[model samples]
Target: MSYIPPHKRQLKDPVSPSPFPDSLATKVMKNTDFKSSSVKVNIAYSRDAIFKWFLIGSKGISDEVPPSIKLVPVSSDSSDSRYGEKSFVLMNTNVEKENVIAEESEEEERTRWMLIAEKVEKDLVVAYEQAKKGMQDHHLSDNAKLRLVARFGKILFRRIHAGPVTEYWQAKSSNRTFCTDVPTSFIQNIKSKAIPSHEFCIDLEKEVYVVQISHYTRPHSTIICKCTVKEDGSLSMYKAELNPLRHLVVDVSCIDKNLDMRFMLAGKRKMFTLTEKERSNIQRMLDSVTVDSTVKGGLTWPHGKPPSENGYTIFEVCHVRATTYKNKTLRLRVRETNGYSERFGTWEVERGVTLILQDINTKLQEQNIERGCVLEMLRDALGTIWDFLHCDASLT
Candidate 1:
């Protein structure tokens, strides 16, 4: 073999045939063609598979979008148009559903509030009716009435303590005394000044002098006297009589600020005395009275003209034994009308008295009497021994 330099070795052409045996070369060409065809078939199959997969993925994306969004066509001019339409439809659908649900909830809430309001109104009406009924049926209790009787006694004591002034003049001489030393002018004046009555002065032309007298303690009783007045100015009594409707008798005494009063209603045949319990109750009520500057003696009814619905006045002082009291002793026997027609039960009197006390205490809470000063004064004036007789004069 001829030796050649390494840099001068000849390069073979790419298109030249192989320098191998024909049979081996043919086998090589066959293997090369088979490999080339296999590669081309694989590439064509991969491209078609990828295109089908892309189409399927696109269809899946369209299915995921809501039908309302899918109906909106994609605009070629604006890339964001399709996305904007889809979002608007989705948002609108969600918002509409939320609005409907909210409206239903709001309607339910309004109905609930109305029901609550109606219930409250009904309760208020019922409560108001009950309160009205209670007020209408209200009445005083037995204890209250007893207190009222005590209050009445205290009022009488007050009047007696203040010196009960009488309205009529008592006859100093005999019941049928005659005036013989009367002047003719005096006779004429007396006849003119005197009120003529059918019973006393039947003939006014006659020179007659008549005097009618009524006592405060015995208002229903009258003393009438008729006298013949001569022109010579002499008055002579011709007739005299006592007209009485009913008799009144009373006995009262005071000792150390305590009153022992007894009364006898002759016409009614009822005799009663103030028990120790009654006196103590009266004292308590008197002490509870408040002092009022507008009233005389700092003690008076806080509410004027106490309610008489119960058929009796609480603090009414009708008769006072003023003239009978002498040297701390009083005795009285007179005729008067029976003002109290109906009999009072113990309960009624107590209820009335309690009501009066409540009214006074409600307005002012202050003690009026100190150590029974007013009562003591009354006791000192009325004396330890007293007697009174009177008719039923309870103001109904």
Candidate 2:
């Protein structure tokens, strides 16, 4: 998973009255004013499903992502018996491999971004504890501290999803642990370096520099983001993805079991929709698995939006040309719709998705094509995790 924090982007200051006359990607419907001091921003969450809309699925089934927190059209006052049934439909798309791969990579980035969950949680905890003592015994002042509590609370709640989480794994000689806070700045330093949370703006004319600061925390675990403040008072949002080879620790035991095709199928009994040809491909793929042999193949996966010139726009996958069975080769992009490329509707493209297919397309043109042993293992892990999330009995 990558670091994908959604924020409103603008090209000028106080964008309430800015004329949004049918841009390429964004469709401005209701008129709203953008205030410098405060602006109302609503978006359908990419993850942490709440209310009616959850994020899209890997297979792009009934994955119609809608605006987050906004009320659905079906109200209790409706006369129809089928109340609360969603009226949404899948976003239209075209047929193309490049576009799908683009969106897939972005989604893949989100999956990898969660690897920083533990670290981010800890950092937030430290921020909270520090904020706690800042109180001067006043009742109202203490309530102000409560605001800081939301930050810490949201971090942990979002990470485990307010659900049961197996947080740590430890053995006699080796152990792994996660925390909500790791001491960074003392109370004194924090006060001085505190950058007040500002509504970030995106400036088109200025240089927008994306910095990936790895050394600020754990060499591979921590990531720091910096972007230019635009004239419209929006700062560019970041979709920081994790590089498995460089960032993730390899689990030998899990790796062994995942690579074993039989082991992967041991508990999975739940049904999945697959064409006969797709089924045949899966079976043939499993039969052909070999140690040290890499298969460079991309899954003919589906995304929510239809494919277009710039891929399917939002929730799309691309550049899925090739990947190592052992190494990751996916690229996901999260951008605004009104920017250079577009996916659909008249809304700012808050975030984007990209999927990775571990097939080395380049190798298809060559004589010798090696398969990636690790990707085989990864596909199983991803499936198992996803199945668990979707409440599939097989994963249990």
TM-scores across all candidates?
Answer: 0.14, 0.18
Compute the lDDT of residue 260 as modeled in candidate 2. Answer: 8
TM-score of 1: 0.14
* lDDT of candidate 2 over 335-355, digit per residue (tens): 212211111112211222112
Residue 206, candidate 1: how far off, in angstroms?
43
lDDT of 1 by residue, 122-240 (tens): 22223223323332354312111111001101101001111111100011110100011112232232223321210123211222333332334433333343444334433343553
Model 2: lDDT equals 0.21
Per-prediction tally of clashes: 22, 69
